[model samples]
Target: MKDSWRRLAERLGGRLAFQAPLRELTSFRVGGPARMLARPEDVGELQELLASARRERLPFIMLGGGSNLLFDDAGFDGLVIKLGAGFAGLEGAGSLVRAGAAAASADLLAWTVARDLGGLEGLAGLPGTVGGAVAGNAGAGPEGLGRAVTRLFVLEGDGRARSIPAADLNFAYRRLEGLPERAVILEAEFALTSRPAVEIRARLAEIRERRGGQPLGGRSAGCVFKNPPSISAGRLIDECGFKGQRVGGARVSEVHANFILAENGATASDILALIDRVRQGVLARRGLALELELKVLGPGGEVRA
Candidate 1:
């Protein structure tokens, strides 16, 4: 199956590599490598690759900005599909904005703001691609991308494109429940209200202010644990005295307890160990079972529990 992807990549002119090091692919910067990695430039190429992988029964996982994700030290055995420049396009009219999957979240936010579009300003400091944000329903506070999104352009395993209404894409806290596990998001359209430029700028500034004290820039996947019930995971962890805790090179950020920062030299094992330690601590001391918010990819690009 690995060789199959390589051969297809050669034929399709898609970027392909064997044993591609993924340490630099993620924000965490603590992964090993991927057995196979393919970056498709366009929807046609992505569909072709997906079709081929499906025919060969080869598992694959979509990788966007590499934010909010962690890869294991052993590396992924399946193909890691990434969208390229062809999917980074952005176009909009009046109060509607259309963006490609590869478009950066920050760029999208800025583009809309420049046009006096109001909807996604809450994502000002978020680090991820449009596709990832939509897939995970990313947000700051109560505002999520799902609220602004009106439509989605997706491709199925059969290489067929479909336009789905946002209402059909039932979104919840950090989850897009209506989307199937195998469906690939190619582009999304957002419906926003026309607002004054000053208002947009003010909202962006407010978000920036609220982001204070959090390690917005770091070698870490945003938040480690999700907010439980009514309280935040950071507050709980801080109350448990886990702030500034270290496990090898991975340490809980003093500024934000939910974030675990990686230093000059850190291993995937170190991050995993730290996460386990925190979970154990919270469960034993606080009687709270922490749930992971960030996605952790196993050796085969499989979801790690």
Candidate 2:
């Protein structure tokens, strides 16, 4: 497998690293290493790499900005493809804006706000990449990223690129459903309303202030669990007295109960254990089962709770 990856690296001629550390890549800051990490320069290279991986029968996973993910302590034994800077372009034509998959959410927000785009003001302080936001349907309150997405350009599992319109998509809470298995989002077009830049900035400021209560600079994923129905997960966890609860080096944030922070010397196991304890406590006390918002990646590239 190492030789196969080496050959693939030579053929692609992009940034490919063996035994790349996964800990530094994620916001959680608690993960092992990846067997192989590849950053493709462009869409053509990405397509070729994916096709080659498939043909070689190698397991592969796509990583965005790594804001909402938790990789296992044992690490991934497969290919980890992260889109390069070439896939981070952003452009605008009137009220419609197009952003590459790897473009940072902060950058996209800034671009739209500068152009007086009103719709994305709700996503002001969101982390991760555009592709991750679109895939997870990231949002602030009732407004989701999918609401602004008009069309998406994706590289399918079969190596075919397709343009999918919003009408054909199924945008649910905290997730974008009905995408083809292994489909990779290349770029997305968002339709936004025209507004004064000052007004947009004001809205953004308001959101930032509201988000000030969260542990912004902490070593943690944004949220640990999704709100159930009309209830807030943080409120429930707080009521359950899980705040400041510690499991090894992972502790529930004192500022926000929904976030589990990783302190120095934290491991993936510590975080996972804390998450389980909090979930059980919430369920036992509140009688409501909270769903996880954090994506836990196992050693085999499978998604865990």
C-alpha TM-score for every candidate: 0.96, 0.97
What is the lDDT, from 0 to 100, of the residue 209 in candidate 1? 92
Tell how far residue 175 is off in model 2, in angstroms.
Answer: 0.3
lDDT of every predicted structure (CA atoms): 0.87, 0.89
lDDT of 2 by residue, 97-210 (tens): 999999999999988888788898767888899999999999887558898899999999888999999999988988898688899999999999999888888888898898
For residue 240, model 2's alpha carbon misses the true position, in angstroms, by: 0.5
Candidate 2 regions with alpha-carbon error over 4 angstroms: 2-4, 12-14
TM-score (C-alpha, index-matched) for candidate 2: 0.97
Q: Tell me how far candidate 1 lies from the true structure as C-alpha RMSD in angstroms.
A: 1.5
Backbone clashes in candidate 1 total 0
Q: Which candidate is the best by TM-score?
A: 2
